[model samples]
Target: MSLVAEHVSVSIDRADLLADVSFTAAPGRVHSLIGPNGAGKSTLLGVLAGDRAPDAGRVLLRGRRLDEWPLRELARERAVLTQEHGVTFAFRSREIVEMGRHPWARTPAEDDDEREIARAMAVTDVAHLADRPVAHLSGGEKARVALARVLAQRAPVLLLDEPTAALDLRHQEDVLRLARAQAADGDAVVVVLHDLNLAAAYSDEITLLQRGRVAAHGSPAEVLTAERIEDVYGQAVEVIEHPRSGVPLVLPVR
Candidate 1:
């Protein structure tokens, strides 16, 4: 599935949160949104997920307007992982994961519920924590559990908002690698990332936003240049090539 945002704009209290932003997340590609804080990365992601209505412009999923899709249909088409992973009640980890299969209830797909839930938990390395109360888990554990729920949904378009924020270095790599694997399996993955290096390493295309507008949009090499990073992030940085992958390595100059 292809998720597209065209001329999308959002405003809050007379302030523009996003202005004329256009983006595309195509199958078999990992497209990343990267920018400084308050650059509207989360806001734009919310719009793309159909959680917030844009003040202007439109969002499309597979050539159809987002609003045109029914809520259940939309849920089956896209899975969103927001920054907040808090659960009000003490739901078990496995139970939380099972929620992702709710959309397929009563349908033939529901027969795979058990298998999919277990697969998602195992893939996220949270299978051992299945029966544990999510409220008792650490922040990183909760994040992984939340991700397991999203993965269990089996949605084609993934809208992840800083999915690795609470994870350690190794788990961060694990999450991004899973994202890449999903894209390789022909899912359209759109991730909001703060780590420019990870974005450069995993993203097939990058959109750099500043003050609600697009600063650059292209491959990592084209959009993540030292000059562009410094201009948008207001920090001096040096770009080097990774010895193994040859992707751009961003190091802040101190």
Candidate 2:
């Protein structure tokens, strides 16, 4: 499935959060949204996920208008991991992950619920904490559990907002690697990322947002130039080829 946003805009209290933004998330690729704080990365993700209706323009999934899809059907088509991973009640990690299966209730896919949940928890390395209360888990653990929930959803389109924020260096790499693996499995993955290097490393395409608009959108090499980064982020930076991976490495100048 492909998710496309055409001239999407969002305004609140007279402030534009996103303006005339156009983007596409195609299957078998990882698309990263990168920008400084307040640059509308999360807002744009929300719009693409259909959680936030755009004030102007529209979002299409599989060439169908996003709003036209039924809620249950939409949930089966895409899975979202928002920035906040708060669980109000004290639910066990396993129970939380099982929530992802709710959309498949009464359907044939429900038969895979147990297997999917277990696979997701294991992939996220949260299986050991399955019986633990989500409220008692550490930040990174909680984040992983939240991710497992999204994974268990088994949707073709995955939209993640700042998924690495709470993770340590190792887990950060794990999460992005998992994203790449998902894309390799023929899923469309769109992620909001603050780490430019990580984005450059894992993303097949990138959209650089700046002040509610798209500053640049293309391959990492094309969009993550030193000059473009400095101009959009207002910081001087050096871009170099990674010694091992050959992807762009962004270094901030002091």
Candidate 3:
């Protein structure tokens, strides 16, 4: 599976949010979308997930237009996890995770589905909160539960919007490692990340956005240069190679 956004641009309320934005994510690869706030990182993900339409370009899945795919068909193959999760209805953690199956599954109450839900809970380290209400969990805990929901989707393409933003350091690594494993298993994972070091460590390719355009796109070594970081982020960033993983490590200037 692969995703390609071609000359994609989005406009809202007389403002251009994304301009000629484009990138591709192939199977077994993790593509990180990095940018400053309002750079349209989340907007691009929304278009890819079919939640929003591009105003001037097209989203392609393996060269086919995304608009041609049915909603159920698309949902069965792709899953999205957004930044803020507001659970208006008070639902149990288990119930919330089980909702991921609703696209292709008719009976989420089945024993097999329950087992999958439990496995997702365990993987996200939220099994202990399974019986708790989603509204009762802490911010990080709720984020993990929401992650469990998408993981349960078992989709080939995963779109995550700053998935680790609310997580603690340990959980951040845990969740990212899991996403990497999924990509290794032949899934395509596209994540929006603010933490450049984390993006460098897990992403096979980095798509750097600046002012609604693609500033850079390539391997971390090729894209995350100190000069580029300084130009796009408007801050001094020291790019160091990880001692163990040989990936880029970004340090902020004080």
Candidate 4:
């Protein structure tokens, strides 16, 4: 099973934002989308999550087109975490996560909703904040709480946009590690990341986009190179092998 982006394109008014872009986020792995600002990472993610309709091509989940999937079935199949997590209420953190169970409401799955919620919170290291008001939390804390909600969703596919943008170093690693663990469990995890090091460390495959088009798509070793980094990011960077892990490590050139 895979979340496929088949020759997707997008245009606003008369300008193109994406053109003939294609991607495949396969099950049982973590795929990362990386690019400079305005590279259409979030736009592509929105299409994959079925929130935006492309002007050309389509997004498919498993083998079914995204537009054709019933809303409830799509919710059950995948969970989307956008850049913004809006909470209008002063609801407790637990309440926010419990909302993830909405798809299972009135169904047999409802019986274990609380258990699922608890497990999700625990995994995201937010269980202790379950009783706290979501609005009172710090940005990092809120990000983790938001992530707990998605974990509670128990969807087979995860599409996250900059999931670690507001986190501390430790928590940043925490989130990526959890993403890896989710992929290890056979879930398809697709994340948009700005930090190339983190993506190199955790992603099984990386898709590099430039000007709304794919520049490279391959294993980290194949896509992330000193030359490619300089060409796409327009900054001098040195790509080196990790001392032990051998994954690519990107460092700014002096």
Per-model C-alpha RMSD: 0.6, 0.6, 1.8, 0.8
Q: Which scores greater on TM-score, model 2 or model 3?
A: 2
Query: By lDDT, is 1 or 3 better?
Result: 1
Q: Would you estimate the TM-scores of all the predictions?
A: 0.99, 0.99, 0.96, 0.98
Better of 2 and 4 by TM-score: 2
Query: Scored by CA lDDT, what does every candidate get?
Result: 0.95, 0.97, 0.91, 0.93
**Model 1 lDDT tens row, 1-254:** 78989999998898999999999899999999999999999999999999999999999998999999999999999999999998999799999999999999988999999999999999899999999999999999999999999999999999999999999999899999999999999999999999999999999999999999999999999999999999999999999999999999999999
lDDT of model 4 at residue 216?
Answer: 98
Model 4 segments more than 4 A misplaced:
none
Which candidate number has the best lDDT?
Answer: 2
- Greater lDDT among 2 and 4 belongs to 2
Candidate 4: the clashing residue pairs are: none
Q: What's the distance in Å from true for residue 143, model 3?
A: 0.4
Superposed by TM-score, candidate 2 places the C-alpha of residue 248 at a distance from the truth, in angstroms, of 0.7
Candidate 4 per-residue C-alpha lDDT over 1-254 given as tens digits, one digit per residue, 9 for 90 to 100: 69999999998997778889999998899999999999999999999999999999989888899999999989999998889876888999999999888988888988989899999999889999999999999998899999999999899999999999999999999999999999999999999999999999999999999988999999999999999999999999999999999999999998
TM-score of 3: 0.96
Model 3, stretches more than 4 Å misplaced? 106-112
Worst 10 residues of 3 by lDDT: 104-113
Global local distance difference test of model 3: 0.91
Residues 1-254 of candidate 2 have per-residue lDDT tens digits of 89999999999999999999999999999999999999999999999999999999999999999999999999999999999999999899999999999999999999999999999999999999999999999999999999999999999999999999999999999999999999999999999999999999999999999999999999999999999999999999999999998999999999
Tell me model 4's lDDT, rounded to 2 decimals.
0.93
The residue pairs in collision within model 3 are none
